[model samples]
Target: MKTEAEIKVAIETYGDMIRRICFLHLKQYADVEDIFQNVFFKYATKREAFDSAEHEKAWLIRVTINACHDFLGSWFKKKAVLTEDFSQFQIDPHSDQGHLLDIVMTLSPKYRDIIYLYYYEGYKIVEIAALLKKNENTIHTRLRRAKQELKEKLGGDYFD
Candidate 1:
């Protein structure tokens, strides 16, 4: 069992990253919340000590991704095909940033994940490749293709 201080530190350090990963993978807020809770629960219960802070963050990311996959595969999730209305929550009415996020969310999970980790989470290609356990070249190819797809979808040189 992990100590309270350790659990608290983990939560404070990686909470946003975990939530962002969950949100990117899941469509519904309810499901995201469930997976988010489950990820922390798993962190608190797991016994392995991380070799470094980077290792700990990577482990959390992996666990969060796995939990999202598990949630998607659950029988209840399979039976329901619900989607959330994004209009209910808006931080800024005039910001076009939300539109970009909407476009990214339209991507398939593979591309969406790579985009989120690379662009949003500030991970380099090498880092993302290592985190996702894919070849560095594969990450490069996916990112290139994903950018093209996004460009086509958004039109008029959306990415710089």
Candidate 2:
């Protein structure tokens, strides 16, 4: 188990990123909170040592993504009435950023993940492929497709 200070530092550093990933995947605030806690709990209990800060962040991102997917795939999620609570987001729905975010959220999870990691997180395609355990070419293709979709939705001027 990681020391209390270490865990605290980890949470302080990555909490917002994890929450953003959760929100992207789950949409609901309640589910985001649950997955956030679960991801940190896993981090606290993890036995392996990270090679670097980047490695640690990547690990956390992977765990958060997996946890969100698991939570969404649970029987409870399927049975429950899931309502989107965008109020948790600070962006105004009418604003351009908010409008873009809305369109991004409307994408399928795979496209959303690619867009979030590539555009929002500033990760390179190679890094995203490594983080997602996919081929570099696959990440490149998805990113192109996602950008194309976004461009179509937001107009060519937005991408240009």
Top-lDDT structure, candidate number: 2
Deviation (Å) of 118 in candidate 2: 1.2
What are the models' TM-scores? 0.89, 0.92
Superposed model 1: Cα runs more than 4 Å off: 81-94
Report lDDT (CA) for all predictions. Answer: 0.85, 0.88
In model 2, the worst 10-residue window by lDDT is: 82-91
Which clashing pairs does model 1 show?
Answer: none
Give me candidate 2's TM-score against the actual structure. Answer: 0.92
User: 82, model 1: CA deviation in Å?
Assistant: 5.4
Model 1 lDDT tens row, 1-160: 7899998989899998888888778856677778888888998899988899988988999889888988888898889867667646433435688788778888888898899888887899999999889999999999998999999998968777
TM-score of 1: 0.89
For residue 125, model 2's alpha carbon misses the true position, in angstroms, by 1.0
